[model samples]
Target: MTTAPTRFAPSGPLTGTVSVPGDKSISHRSLMLSALAVGESRITGLLEGEDVLATAAAMRAMGADILRGDDGVWTVHGVGVGGLMQPGQALDMGNSGTSTRLLMGLVASHAITCTFTGDASLSHRPMGRVIEPLSAMGADVSASPGGRLPLMVRGLAPAVPLEYRLPVASAQVKSAVLLAGLNIPGVTRVIEPVATRDHSERMLKGFGADISVETDADGARIISITGEAELKPQTIAVPGDPSSAAFPIVAALIVPGSDVTLTGIGMNPTRAGLIGVLRDMGGDIETLDEREVGGEPVADLRVRHSALSGIDVPPDIAPSMIDEFPVLFVAAAFAKGTTRTSGLDELRVKESDRIAVMAAGLAEIGAQVEEAEDGLTIIGTSGDMLPGSAHPIASSLDHRIAMSFAVAGLHCRDGASVDDMHPVQTSFPTFEPMLRGLAEA
Candidate 1:
């Protein structure tokens, strides 16, 4: 596959209503959980992107029969609980840390020996966070140096389930431990000091897994899932990805006289903090037709251009919207005053070093931004556009950074470009096209 450079220039006000792709996180869990259930599971609005495709392929390698209909519906026949066979080849997870970590958990207690591999980016991510707890549960896992990928696992069915306290705030790590416990005969518990997305737990329960959550002192969440549990096949209607909808939402906020309506955006409280943060910054965002879908909150957002002002972001909200920071930084650029964010140590370890990349790119665009070890301090432009420099930002093959600056360029005077837009296929394949369509106001 050839890597391509892409650029975006100043555009007209965005005025339209559009639906984004399916939630990548939910889509991954849908496929995984659906593949774990007996009988047939039907899923609509599944994200047809590279990363989720990797998850689909990995499940297929494990003997789940997954097929797509002419109308884009997915029908999957799961191998059922504890029925996974040892794959003949290594599972290749292409540039998806979510797939790699979560599936590692699924494979942990299956009595199957599986080799897990990935592309260059996913290969570099540390698997130790998952390995530590899964190892404690008696799954035999071995990784490359520094506990990275190209790893292998020999699972022990009926693996021991243990109580885990998260040392960090990662939904992926939390979900991994829970997914691994699905085959164990007892309670599998994860105590999170910082709450992350609860998609896995929510979806697991929807599939008929016995799971419950309780809040402890200090507001930590204790999620317990009972395993040796059967997950009934479900017909899931996946909502639009809030993360994918974020680009257009922010674009509408920063672009002058713009009003864009995004429908079917997931509003799960744990994952919808970005809306609250942006609202606090004086963004003219409205939520209408709020309702429930597939056990998660869903809503339509009508975002109109407003005069944004920067403020201190609550550190506790970091886990809720970790993936939205790159675009949030772009919004910070177009706001007034300084936007200060902390408690983002995890940003350093995402698909790219988001902190360093965002700070550097903002500086390149003539935005006054300061980078810290864990966070950033961005002095906003007070409604003025950044000086888009001649050089293109090096996207580092991360999809969010590439798409974020593309949104920033919509408001910048000189426009901006990215080193590689190909990575956008990982999460939001329709990003460039959707953005272009939105420009037709």
Candidate 2:
């Protein structure tokens, strides 16, 4: 497929009811844990985007019988815990860091050697965080000097379980360690300074693993899992991604005279920090038709345009909305006053340096942004034209960065232009079309 560059021009109010793609995080985890389960696990509402499809393909390469039914449901006949065969070739993970890193944990304990590779963007992300922990647990992992991708992992049989304390708040690193422990002989424990998303823990328990979480006096969470539990397959229905819904939700809140209803969105508290920040910014968003879906909270979000004010975002909330900083920066650009955000070191290690990318993009578009060691502070323009001349923002092929800036352009003085929108396919392939549809509506 050829790469394409696209630009967004300033637009009017966006109005519509739309369903975003299935939760990318949950979609990836469901396929992986289900593939490690004992029987046929049926899943509906899985994201078919390139990143997730790459994960499904990786699972198949690991000997899981994964297929899509004629009715469009996905079914996985897993080889069960410890039953995965040595893959015959390198697992091409495409642009999915979630797949590559999480699968690394799973592959680390088996008696096999699997080489993992990805596209240029993924190749640049640091994999050493995962490698360090897994290596300590007896896995032989070798990577480029900077711990980048295109690495080889030699699994160890009867691997020793480990007790690790996370220096950074990352669900990916925690999930990787826990997955590796599944094939080890003893209990594996991980202590997190700040609680990251718990989808992996929840899904692991649903698949019948022996895992427990406890909160200490210092507010740290210690997760312990006993290895070698038999996993039983169950049907799964993935909730709509809150991360994906964030775009339209913010659009409705920022665009004058706009109202929208986003349905079946995951409201897992860890991922709902965006909603909290938006509400505090005085956005008129409400939750209706609330219920549970597939072990997750789901709700229909109704948002209407409202005057927004900036507020300080606590560092503690960083983990819940780590993927949302870029979009939040967009919202901050249009709000009144200044918004301060901290505890964002994790943002630097994502698909791109999100903090740096957003700072540069926001600065180019007229928002006064200051980049700090761990976060950024934005002085809003209150919907005014950017003071300086405008220029196109470089996306570096980061899908979230591209989409966030596109949304920002909607409210910019001179609509923003982004280079290389082709990377949007890695997650939300329908993003541009969906945004266009909203404009037409």
Best by lDDT: 1
TM-score (C-alpha, index-matched) for candidate 2 = 0.97
Model-by-model lDDT, in order?
A: 0.92, 0.88
Q: Tell me, by TM-score, which candidate is best.
A: 1
- Candidate 2 scores a C-alpha RMSD against the true structure in Å of 1.6
Writing each residue's lDDT as its tens digit, candidate 1 over 1-441 gives 766667788888999999999999999999999999999999999999999999999999999999999999999999888988889899999999999999999999999999998888778788999999999999999899999989999899889998999999889999999999999989999999888999998999999999999999889899999999898999999999999988999999998989999999899998898999999999999999999989989999999999999999999899889999999999999999999999899888889899999999999888999999989999999988887865889888899999999998888888998888988999899998888888885
lDDT of model 2, residue 62: 88
RMSD of each: 0.9, 1.6
Using Cα atoms with residue i matched to residue i, what is each candidate's TM-score against the true structure? 0.99, 0.97
Backbone clash numbers for all candidates listed: 0, 0
Q: Which sections of candidate 2 miss by over 4 Å?
A: 1-4, 385-391
lDDT of 2 by residue, 52-111 (tens): 999998889989999998888999999988988888899999989999999999999999
Q: Give the Å error, residue 281, model 1.
A: 0.5
Candidate 2 residue 84 Cα shift, in angstroms, is 1.1
